[model samples]
Structures are given as C-alpha cells and as structure tokens.
Target: MTGPRLSTRLRFGAAALLVAVGAAASVAAAPDLPARMVTTWDAAGEPTGTLSKTAGMWLVPGLAAGLLGLFALLPRIDPLRENVAAFRVHYDRFVVVLTAFLVALHLSVLAVNLGYAVDVTTLAVAGGAALFYYLGTLLPHVEPNWFVGIRTPWTLSDDAVWDRTHALGGRLFKLSALIAVVGLFVGEYAVYFLVGPALATAAVTAAYSYVLYARRGDDGSDPDAAGRTAK
Candidate 1:
C-alpha cells in the first residue's frame, strides 16, 4: 500500500537477489575467514560458538533459499489459494522481509568473520523488530488461508473469527515491535524485549480466537463455516 504494487515475480526476484548477494559475499570472503566461523553470540555480542567455515558460510543462504521456495509453493498449494491471491502483495512483502532478515544476519556474520567489529546481537534484535513490524502490517490485510496469518481451529472455521483475531494480532504485533525497539537502549536485556512480547502476543491472539469462537456458540463442525462450497 505504501508504494507501487509489485508483481509476484518481482517480489520473489528481490528475495532471490538477497540470498544470492549473501552467497556471493560469503564466497568473496572465504579465503579471509578462519577455519571455524563464530556463528553464535550472547546478548552482549560475545561469541558463543563456532561452525566449520564452509558450513557456517552457507547455512543461512541455504535456509533463505529453502524458505523462498517454500513461500512460493505454499501459496500455490494452499486449499484457499484464492484467498492467498487476494493478499498476495502483502504476503510477498513478508517473504521479502523474512529473506532480508536472514540475509542480513548472514552478511553480519560474514562481516564479523572478516574481522569487522559488528554487534551481531544488536543487528539481530533490530532485524527481528523490523520483521515483526512488517508482520503487523501484513496481518490485518490477510485473507483466510491454510498457510499464513494466525491459524487456529477457531479462525480456520470462521472468517469472522479470522478477521477479528488478525485485527487484534496486528496491533499486538506492532506493540511488540515497538517494545523491541525500546530494548535497544537497555543493554543485556535487549533480546528479552523481542522474545517476551512476541511470545505473549502469539499466546494472546490464539486465546482471543478461541474465546471468540466459543462465545459464538458453535461447535465448529459445519463445513459451510470454512467458506467451502460442495461440488
């Protein structure tokens, strides 16, 4: 909604480019990296563990590629493919966000291995915050689909429940993202800002969906409730 609507091909291409750039960067930096790359870090940005250089270099790119493939396939195969189509723009935006986040992490790791003094934990927290903010933006616009949005038995069974829950979820998610931003200034407690509120938002949204479903007084067995038409 903020800019020109992008074609699925373009959005996916953007995500692919991010993965490719990270892969290329890894390759370019290969000779300079140590035998083992420090891959894990504590909240204070202290290195916690390492991965064999090759494995560390490729792992995130591989995961990003795999996720890109999965995101492409899921929309096509979902039972409510039409619903996914209705919100394809936002969904694609989310895919790009997720891809960018992973690639950023990959490049950040690459930078660290190249002896750059990068604070990876801060980068992760910032990336996670951005991801959640995008998710908040996407949720309210999402249509009922098997693969995305806040899926629960209640939300799946009724479009009203799905809409209501997602609306609430959108706000909670945005709030959590803001809370995560606040953590950036708090020192070692930074990660807790991202984790705590995100987890709470998820739990709250699922429960809200359940309670709303029950309050509607349906046992949720009716096929028509799922927006399906019998052939």
Candidate 2:
C-alpha cells in the first residue's frame, strides 16, 4: 500500500516550532550581536567568516522553510510521485529530522557567539551523524523515484537494481554515520570523518547500481524503464 502523505502535523507543529524558536532567539539576541557575526567555520571548527547580524540570525530558519517547501512540493512534481507516496510517512519524518538538525546547529552558533563555550563543530558533527543514520533507515523503504534514494542510470532502469542498490546504500550509510560520530572525539579531524564516509557511500552506491544494471542487461532484463525513476 502507498504510505500516508506528508503529515500536516509535521508541517504545522514540529517544523513550525523549530522555526519559531529560531526566530525568537534571533530577536532576543539581536541587540547584543555585532553588526557582523561570525557565521562560517573551518573543518577544524574554527570560526572563518562572518555575516550581517540580520542574515546570520535568519539564515537557518529561512533555509528550513525553503527546504520544507521543496520537500512538500517534490511529490507533486515527480513523475513517480506514487512511489514517493509509498514511503511518504518516512519521508515526512525525514523532513522533521533534518529541520531539527538545522535548528540545533543554528542554536549552537548563536550560543557560541553569546560567549557560551559551546563546541559548535562537535555539535554539528554529532547532529550530522544522527541525520545520516536516520537516512540509512529510510533508504531501503524508498520506492524508485526521481527525488530520493540511490538514483543511478541502472537503478532507475530496473526495479531489481533499485532495490539491491538501496539495500546496500542503507547499510553503507549507517556505517558512514557510525564512522562520522567517531569524529566527535577526534578534535579537528572530526569533519573529515563525516565527509570521507559520506563520499565513499555515494561513490559505492552509484557504482553498485551501475554494476547491477549491466549485469541485469546481460541477463536479459529490460533496460527501458528509464523514464519512471532515476536521474
């Protein structure tokens, strides 16, 4: 059966709550913040760049709103939207998780600038690990679609390829999340832990999909299902 559509509760409640908190914090902190605030950090978690106080405060909330909008829109625009509905419940939860991650990061940044000794980078890496781990759980349940999962030339062409590749992807992503979490304690090298594993998972999943595609072709499976799902 197709999964339920994106939850109105998520859209109006959890997401709204996060955005509201971000905005409220921005308002409360605006007076004490400098005209420009440090907003970028290097991989080592050192502050590297700045943004206007107004921009700094609103950045994540604005981005979150945009992302939530896009997430809500994708199912309508996708050709394989029915497949998206097949996992819509998971999809909605993913949206909430991602928004919360951003909110956490935004709050960390605000606190650090306020003289709190928050290790913003450590918090970011940890949040990333959580997000990636949840994504791992979500992948295997994804039906073939243009907007999500391990899309590749091969996976999009065949349902069997999509399933196997996503299954592999699900495992690899979880492993990546685990590896990334170790970065939380590795000091300056922590960001690399997340980046390295994530990149490897992407490369491995794409290659796996292609290999599955070619083998299926050799085995005489139809390769003409392209328009249904894939990049």
Estimated TM-score per prediction? 0.91, 0.90
Expressed as tens digits, the lDDT of each residue in 1-231 for candidate 1 is: 434245888999999999999999999999999999999987777889999999999999999999999998998799889888888999998999999999999999999999999989988999999999999999999999988999999999888889989999999999999999999989785988999999999999999998878777445444334554543
Ten contiguous residues with the weakest lDDT in model 2: 1-10
Model 2 lDDT per residue over 1-231, tens place: 322423545453687788789878889988888888888889987889999888999999899888888887888899998898888888888888998999998988888778788888788889999999999999999999998988788888889888988999999989999998888877886999998999999999998888767865566574655644665
Looking at candidate 1, what is the lDDT of residue 51?
99
Q: List pairs with backbone clashes in candidate 1.
A: none
Question: Candidate 2: lDDT of 41?
Answer: 88
Deviating ranges (above 4 Å) for candidate 2: 1-8, 217-219, 222-231
Best by lDDT: 1
Q: Tell how far residue 67 is off in model 1, in angstroms.
A: 0.3
